[model samples]
Target: MSDLREVAITSDSSGQLWNACVWDPFVGTTLMTYKGGVSNSHCLSFIGRDFLISGDAVKPLLHVWALNRQEQIQVRMVCPGKVGALAISPDGSYCVCGIEEKLHVWQVATGRLMAVIPRHFQRVTCIRFTDDTTHFASASEDGSVIIWPLCKVVSMTQDIFRSISDSAEPRYTFSDHSLAVTNIFIGKGGMRARLVTASLDGTSKIYDLASGIMLLSVVFDVGLTCVTMTIAESRVFLGTIEGKIHPLCLHTPPRSLDYHLTETEKQNVFSEHTKSITCLSVSVDSSMLLSGSLDEQVIIWDVPSMQCLRKLQHKGSITNAFFAIVPMNVFSNNLKPSLVLSSFKRRSDTENEESYCINVLNSERILCDKKSENKESLKYLAGQVLQLKSQVKSLVGANLELYRGLIADVWDGHDDDEPDPSFESTQEVGVHKKRKIKHKKKRNLET
Candidate 1:
């Protein structure tokens, strides 16, 4: 009974090599790790639960994997330009790839190029589709959020070539930020979607899609790297480079004096990640929170209890990890610990002093790929892959054991209604404190 999970990661620490690793949580081990000749591999998406899309700056080729099997299976499709970001539709029928200056739309089943969106100031940073699939939006480094009508793009394609069909026209473009936009996310629900975007300018803005008007602008103390909304859309979580979490609620006033800090909801700042925050993921039910950081650590936090679950170790600064939903969630202790996708790069000799050499735990077999001519780089990459595989295998084995324990406990009545000791004793809530605002400086800088 393997508990398989998916985790993806990127390693940019080593300027020379780019690597990606996948951890199968059910099997409790890293099923595969890839490195070498890959310049940049970002914007990963699953095509129909079978293929994985990943590529870099020079190569516009999208590396597709049939997830049904373990190995990197095929190159399903190749785009015209470098893919900077990618997003698959909610229903998994289509996918949008954002290149340096264009957006390409493709059909998931056949890998046919459907359309190309041209003429942008810089690379598209992120792309997302509406729930209905009627429209899609893409963000650029140029500080603009463009919304395209899917019906129009599809209709225009019959007469024109497929590549020129689904262009992301400007439904609304936001240029309020003086700096480049870093991330953008559309809220869940129905029509008139809410667009929340963050940038290098240390500000997060919410937009009304129907009216194309700015709803709220949140100015934080530091630059925000990533932003995500809870499943209920009642709370917004912002992560900063300084390794802090700012939780804001949609129900409260966006700019009131007490808006940022609520009386009942305590502010718990977890300083587990030593470096910059790379990615943040909250479970669908908002019970668990996952943070990947440049410090090469993955910290899982129990949301309601505010206790650290397990500081999962990794080889490189975790590029990203998604809590992918699977069948095991229904019978598991914590459904949030399903799949994690992390990417890492080789480290320099300086970093090796603190980082342990990657080793496979609880397994007798070891990977035989020795260091190449570049001993240092090979050692780092080899260690990274070994560690990733070890973590994946552990997850797979542990998940099966957890499920088996759950069944036995259910039948034996030994663990029923008993809270996990790991969660209860450390449940001390954090206190609330307010930071003095420099209104004059804020006004002076904005002006």
Candidate 2:
């Protein structure tokens, strides 16, 4: 099994050549390009590893393409409004879009619109999913960031164009920011991870997602435009409208009473871009940092040295820039990934979802096109496809019931024994879960 290399993925708003391009940062080589998916900031993303999804920059259309393809497929899925930000679950089972003041949730594989949640009073600015894909946080212009459990949000409706009831509130509605929230970044470890959100109010707030408590607040002089952390999250980087990147250490909370990040506290600030920063992402190995700016430059920096390595120039302002793994078989003609199960329908109009679903890829058609590959190659590829599909399906269903029950215990009364909300260690969480299971068994026996 080949462990594929990571590449820098980027896009520009006024791209005439290509909307999305894959580049090898080390050698400064453009490996691939995908056209027709013109999107603004935070609108270009991967729907799992096999598909690329982007919202149109100036229109309300959604464009999707497979890994190897350059143009979008024939399946057209339109949104009611222009998308501001979009995120898909890691398993590719669900997709959520921030369209104006509403958050639209959809079942990706089936192309069914599950719920239209109107939680924010103003337009949503950013949306992010947890590393475990169980919960998602949405930030809006109303100066609020709300964390929502994934399963309950999708369970609000099974029909087309349904509104989420008043009773279905978010898991945690945080109104800590005084101005519009510009960016959101959730750390790893699922609910136990910390949530960092930056706002135009010139502050970055960190919250404990599991306990819904504010851990620390770092105030900056200039308003922040983007935010990201390293793999270990020992430090956080905040991008500003002044075209400077500020870094803060997590351990050095001031000896004084108020824990604040001031001008003197910022040990070193990065000043490379001439315009406001649009997006920032750190490499998986925590050795490099990538930042995109409105000055039409995407600069890669060495994290250890804090020096610029190279720059990727664009004709227009850079919109989206991040790191992604490029699979080894992306350019292989014989082992192309098939996406026949997804429909990408605009809306769910009928009771029987399976009746009108569209099949984008056909096995017979592919076999006819690739006549040079041997039968052994085709057989092995087919087996790999089946195994991957089964694995993805299992991942989507696994831990869903467990997380749903945990969330229900948080909101509703504990009809059953449940773990404490503010868990401190892995050992404590496991012990509490086992106790809950044993208590439930006792209740069943008594009944």
Tens digits of lDDT, candidate 2, 1-447 = 243688999999886988899999898889889898577778888876677888888888888877678877787778888899899887777888898998888777667776778889999989999989999999999999999998778663544334343445689999988999999999988999999998999998889999999888877778999999887878898999999998877877353423566547565888899999999999889888899999999999998888999999998899899987776545655445544325444544545543434335445746443555676688999999999999988987887878998898887775565776566477787999999999999999999
> What does candidate 2 score on TM?
0.75
Give per-residue CA lDDT, model 1, range 42-157, as digits (tens): 36655444345565545656554444433354343456666778887775666777778677766554444556667468878878777787778887788777877766654444
**Candidate models: Cα lDDT each:** 0.62, 0.83
Q: Best TM-score goes to which candidate?
A: 2
What's the lDDT of the predicted structure labeled candidate 1?
0.62
155 in model 2: Cα distance from truth in Å? Answer: 1.6
State the RMSD for candidate 2: 28.6
